[model samples]
Target: MIVTADGSAREPNFNRHITTPNMRKKSINMMYQWFVVSLVYYGLAMNSANLGTDPYISFAASAIVGIPATLFSAVILKYLGRRLSLSGTMLLAGITCLVTALPWPANLNWVIVTLATIGMFASSGTYGICFLYSGELYLTVVRNIGLGSNSTWARASAILAPYVALLGMYRREYPLLIFGVLAISASIAGLFLPETQDQELPETLEDGENFGKKQRFWTLLPQKPSIDNNSAVEQ
Candidate 1:
């Protein structure tokens, strides 16, 4: 394992995910991912609020939504991809949340609730996609830990969420806006990672590289070199 600048030992393997020969099918798998995940994830989240007309209804609706919603997540993750599922969930959740937050007709409260529910449904799908997809994508050695890390981080958000809500939520619509922005951000982060819907476990570093692909990261560079031969490539 190579030591990164921060002195941490990076994974010895290069391919961050498993590989599948059928690239087309694997990539196509992504399309189903987002919508499916959103169906489950955001569904549960919104149920606590969007499920009904008032907070109590929302709470009751949220509880009701969780039952079938979780089951659906299981069903979809069995068929869809990890990356696509997650990204789709993020996008749909973000979009729908944004839509719900918009200033529309007073009569449209029901419409907003409907829209919010749809986003919640998609959120569950995303949760499934992320867990199953990433687990299968990575090699055996790191698979559990990698997926675990991801799962932990995700759970952390949920755990801390109530605190966040308690801290801020001045406006009635503020939480929706926050959720919308967060969903968008998560989708963007999903794009930065690799796609591993249906594939074989990567055996070598090169395999991981081929699968994961380079992504945007911070870089530090020194100034340009001088124009001399001693400074060879200098400007």
Candidate 2:
């Protein structure tokens, strides 16, 4: 047993979470992940006009696209698992945006517009998944604190998103390239986090300390738990 700052007794193992090197690393990484995700997601959203579409139409279309993307992300989260779905969508979003950033002929404006909308769709999906992922990743005791802290970072991202998009004023592709790089970076960072889809939410600091230690790659495929007993029950 251990006593906390508030003089409360805790489970004997609970103290380990406070001192665990892995836990600290994961927490710091997640902070960066949330910031990057928010920055790119909103940056693309606010700068939709750069896609060469009517700004009003693009905004409405982006909102409409998000409806289905959210529903589809639920299915993606269920089957593809959190890690792959996030990384895949983010990678797709980044690639599509980078495609627009290329020095293509003006004749390809329609292609660029199409890619921007697709990137928006992917970014929306990634943003939604992050909400679910962050909620589940934190322990009950500190879940609100963790989420609040992340939200603050997200707001910071939101504030910077507009300025980042302003780069497009100087060079049209500047914002697109920036969004692409950040989205891809977020995807890579996501790879380091554990898959949380359908898995039991961490209820205590100890559970969080041990979270993501189990390897259940590609929840899309079927696997026998005979080899690893924890596999079947983790999700």
Candidate 3:
């Protein structure tokens, strides 16, 4: 039984979760974000060897950088809120990926490696945040279904990432270029999603539909009490 907005209980209907306007919009946005995050994360890892560095070193660096990035993501998610944290990391990844694709002097291979590593770091952070953010965005009644669908999209993108990397055969920058564009686009899409930090998770269809309705596009942090307002109230 699901408790609705009006305090009535009813059997959960799976179809309503998908058909509702707000729920549908949020799901689409999350699916796109998941797809891009998976593609870039896997794509960069797969193409690390082609970034003008030793394959073993590049691969190992990619694996190791994720640790600090995940920690940084946790810190930012606690303060910056889900929408900003995800979008900021994705935007950073996108910009770095694009910069890494730029033609540079052959002697500057280390520069390429550095930029690629940063992109990987940001992508890694975004990947970790998506798991928590998606859970919060979904209604409790269909949370599992929502997460499964997003995961399916992510896996599908992962499968296609190798093909994206293969484009590097024609031009080494092609893979990063694609990944960058997608990440930037996903970042923009993420802004439209409601910030879920410190907010109650929706349990019913009505709750899902109404969730975050009051927030504007620029609202990135949780609301806090104003000192002036509190002082005035005390007076």
Candidate topping TM-score: 3
Among all windows of 10 consecutive residues in model 1, the one with the lowest summed lDDT is 215-224
Each model's C-alpha lDDT?
0.55, 0.78, 0.91
Q: Tell me the tens digit of each residue's lDDT in model 3 across 46-140.
A: 99877777888888888899999999999999899899999999999999999999999999988888888899999999999999999899988
The TM-score of predicted model 2 comes to: 0.81
Q: What is the TM-score of each candidate against the true structure?
A: 0.61, 0.81, 0.87
Ten contiguous residues with the weakest lDDT in model 2: 217-226
Whole-model alpha-carbon lDDT for candidate 1? 0.55
| lDDT (10s digit) by residue, model 2, range 1-235 | 7799999997876434365566677777677777877887788878877666577776776677788888878888887777788888889888988988888787776677678788888888888888887787788888788888888888899899999988887887999998888888877777887766556667867787887677544343322334456766786
The pairs that clash in candidate 2 are none
* Total clashing pairs in model 3: 0
Cα misplacement distance, residue 201 of candidate 2 (Å):
3.5
Off by more than 4 A, model 2: 1-17, 216-235
Q: Measured by TM-score, how close is model 1 to the native structure?
A: 0.61
Task: Return whichever of 1 and 2 wins on lDDT.
Answer: 2
Clash totals for all models, in order?
A: 30, 0, 0
In model 2, the Cα lDDT at residue 70 comes to: 88
